[model samples]
Every structure is written in C-alpha cells, then in structure tokens.
Target: MANIQYVTKEGLDKLRAELDHLESVERPKISQQIAEARDKGDLSENAEYDAAKEAQGLLEMRISKIKDQVANSRVIDASQLDSSKVSILSSVKIKNTANGMEMKYTLVPETEADLSKGKISVNTPIAKGLLGKVVGDIAEVSLPNGMEMKFEILDIKID
Candidate 1:
C-alpha cells in the first residue's frame, strides 16, 4: 500500500499539472521515439529500439509512481489548521536550547519541501519531533550525525 501524503491545495494542483504534462506530452514523445526506432531496423539487432524501449519503461514507471502519489495524497486546509500546536503546514519558530540559535521552518509535504525557503517535510526527523508540540514546549530531535538537539517551540502559524 502507498503511504498517505499530505499536501496543500496548490501542491496537489501542481502534482496534477505535472501528471497531465507527463501523460499528454512526455508519453507521446516516448511513443514517437519508439516508433521511429522501430522503423529503423529489425528488432533483433537494433540498439536504438532497445534504448527507446528502456526509456519507455522508465517513463511508464515514473508515471505509475506519480499516479500512486496523487492517489494517496490528502489536501490539508491551511485556514482550518490549528495554530495551537505544530502540525503539517504549520510555520514554526524554534530556538535551539543548546546554542540559543533561532530558526523558523514551515512543515510541509515532501513535494513542497524547499530547504532554501525554510520549508521542511513533515516526515523529516526534526519535523516529526516538533509535531504536536505547542509554544514553550521543548522537542528533542535526533540528527544524522548521531547527535541529539533540543529546540523550544516559540511560535506556530498555519498561514
């Protein structure tokens, strides 16, 4: 079974647009390539045909994976989200307990996660630790470097 993924309405629309592009544009391009390759020579000795077939297989797999992602996706309403605690689509401000460094991150779906924009995926370790934590609560998160860090929730916003 595919894992459920939470996304905003805009994120869902982006996914749908990408899927539509892949189906309407990319799929035909691959089909055309296959057809052109097939017209070149016999199936037994044609390297181009083999390559096109492999490309088509990869394209199909990508399409299927995206389809599954879309199917399991759930849209999160930003306006209805509670700002009392950290959750998906919440923009949280936290301060590191050890270093006293402050940082803000928006917990979003994987598809919408952009490190440059300070958006972190809800499935990430830090975000998971922060989830359900309200202002003034501390969250202890394990990092990839085998170090544990503590962060104090300062603020939470849905928008």
Candidate 2:
C-alpha cells in the first residue's frame, strides 16, 4: 500500500507542476535526443541512444513516483491546525535542555523539508518526539547516532 502523505496545498501544487514539466518538456526533449541518436547509426553499439534511453527511463520513474505521491497526498488546512500542540504545519520553538540552545522549525512533509528554511520533516526524530507536545512539555528524542536529547517546547503556532 502506498503511504498517504500529508502536505500543504502549495507542496501538492509544486509536485504537480514538477510532474507536468517532466512529462511535457523533459519527456519530449529525451524523445528527440533518442531519435537523433538512432539516426546516427546502428542501435547495436550506440552509446548516445543507450544514454538517452536510460535518461528517459529514469525520468519516467520519477514521474510515476510523483504521480503516486500526488494521488496519495492530502493537503492540510493551515487554519484548522491546533496551536496548542505540535502537529503537522506547526511552527515549534524548542530549547535544548543540555546546552540551552534554542531552535525553531516548521514541521512539514518529507518532500517539503528544507533545513535552511527551518522546515523539518515530520519523520525526523526531533519532530516525531515533539508531536502532540504542548508548551512547557519536555520531549525526549533518540537520535540516529544512538544519543538521547531533551527539548523543551516553548511555543507552537500554525505557520
């Protein structure tokens, strides 16, 4: 079964746009390349033709995957999100217990996660631990490196 991904409307639109670009622009370009390569010589040992075919295959795979994601995606309404607890689309401000370091992140789907933008994937360890947590709640998270860390939730807001 394909996993149902929860995404924002903007995220879903981005995926759809990408899929359209791959199918309309990229697919035709690759087809042209394959046709040009085939006109060059025999197909038995044509590296250009082989490369073009491989690229087309990869592009098709990407399109298929994106289509699947689009089909299974459910867009979350930002206005409907609860600000009292950490959840998808919630911007959370947390302080590390050990060093008192503070960080803010918006919990999003994996496809929309951008570390530089302070958007963290919900599947991430810190986000998972923070889920359903309210202000002043302490969340214990186990990192992939086998280290445990504690974060105190300072605030939650729909962003």
Best-performing candidate as measured by lDDT:
2
TM-scores for candidates 1 onward, in order: 0.91, 0.95
Compose the digit string of candidate 1's lDDT tens values, residues 1-159. 669988889898988898999999999998999899889879999998898899989989988998998999999978887889999989999999999999999999888999999999998999999999999999999988899999999999888
Q: After superposing candidate 1 on the true structure, give the runs of residues whose Cα lies further than 4 Å from its correct spot.
A: none
| Whole-model lDDT per candidate | 0.93, 0.96
Stretches of model 2 off by over 4 angstroms after superposition: none
Q: In lDDT terms, how accurate is model 2?
A: 0.96
Candidate that scores best on TM-score: 2
For residues 1-159, write the lDDT of model 2, one tens digit per residue. Answer: 879988899999999999999999999999999999999999989999999999999999999999999999999998987889999999999999999999999999998999999999999999999999999999999999999999999989897
Clashing pairs in 1: none
C-alpha RMSD values across all candidates: 1.6, 1.2
